[model samples]
Target: MARIKPQALLNQSKKKKGPSRISISTIVVCNLVVAVVVLSLVTTYRHWSQRSRNTLETQSQSHRFEDTNAASEQKSYDLPGYADINTSKGLITVELFKDASPEAVDRFLDLCQKDHFKGMPFHRVIKNYLVQAGHSQSSIPVEEWTSKGKLRGRLNTSPKHEAFMLGTPKTKGNNNKDFELLITTAPIPDLNDQLIVFGRVLKGEDVVQEIEEVDTDEHYQPKSQIGIISVILKREL
Candidate 1:
């Protein structure tokens, strides 16, 4: 074999070096692309996880709030007695406490048994408060007379205004009478002693208020007739 020339040897060396340069550049570019892709995937996964957790927390908090509010408005009783009064305004239902005020409740039941309140007008009403009527012929007071049928004692008298007595509770020495109407509210001082507080308007207080708001004459008669078509009470045997 002839001795290899120096220029030929140099040319062979250049050819070998070209492949190494291309391989090194390719390796560096591939590593950079891989690093960028990995960082992007990590960022996206973290964002998605945080959003999911936030949504779950919000829904849980909303449910807790609604549960608390609903419980606050709910009312129930141990005794099982109810009165449903149908009036021109609408239906006004009441759940009474017979065990708490037995005598007064009995009096009310007696009147209901007699059909006493049928077709009676709601004689009185106060806004956001009560509508009252039970002025039957029997409720009218009898005048006093002597044994000879002559006017005796005071000579002239009026029916005892016991309508308010039912709205009142028992005092230090008195028992509350029965057969009247009342509704509850934030509580009032005058009502503390005078009203028997037989029952509350469980629903349809808006109708009560509507009756109260109607224009009244000097005697407190509503301009529009608001009457009790019927009164019903039910008790479990």
Candidate 2:
């Protein structure tokens, strides 16, 4: 120690310093790298979260639009329900009011659904008066109608049968069987409610007119064979 020079002491002092410049630089670089990695992680997380939020919002909007369309379509059609009576002439759709005549409507709908009126002729057609169909027999024998007290003379009432009325003549007796279906082109209320009025024409009045105008024999049977091909029951609009 007594022989040590000043330069040696200075060298010793440099060796004992807090840290080398290179070591401090290395620590600063490591810290910078760690900071950059943390910043990247934060930016990636933010971007993913934003994208997920946008996707969810788009799906929600699409669902709402679909629901709205479905509701609108349902509301536009089939108010109370009806039927399509297809004939050789054309389609005749009738909208039933069951509340007015429940039994008549029920029987008519059943017959139509079963195709009971298929190939039946509108045998009776009095121009601008009434058109009759939905029976296998051309006419309910005159005696049968008279015996049931439905001959349209017992009660001489006012008003010729109203236009476009779907009615069944109450010719069936105490057994309560449903009878012939007739649509009145003009008002003829003299039959004393002989026809159980039920439903009315909804569409195809022109077809009815065509059927009425066809040429007929002396017995009121159509010469051109205007018959019912089918009766399609349209329970909805």
lDDT of each: 0.57, 0.72
> What is the C-alpha local distance difference test score of candidate 2?
0.72
**Considering only N, C-alpha and C atoms within 3 Å, which residue pairs clash in candidate 1?**
166-196, 167-195, 167-196, 168-194, 168-195, 168-196, 169-195
TM-score of predicted structure 1: 0.46
lDDT of 1 by residue, 50-84 (tens): 99999999988988888776664342233346777
Candidate achieving the largest TM-score:
2
What TM-score do all the candidates reach, one by one? 0.46, 0.55
lDDT of 2 by residue, 92-169 (tens): 888776667767777776676667777877878877667988555533453433243344446554332468878877
Rate residue 133 of model 1 by lDDT.
Answer: 60
User: In model 1, where do residues sit more than 4 Å from their true spots?
Assistant: 1-80, 136-178, 184-186
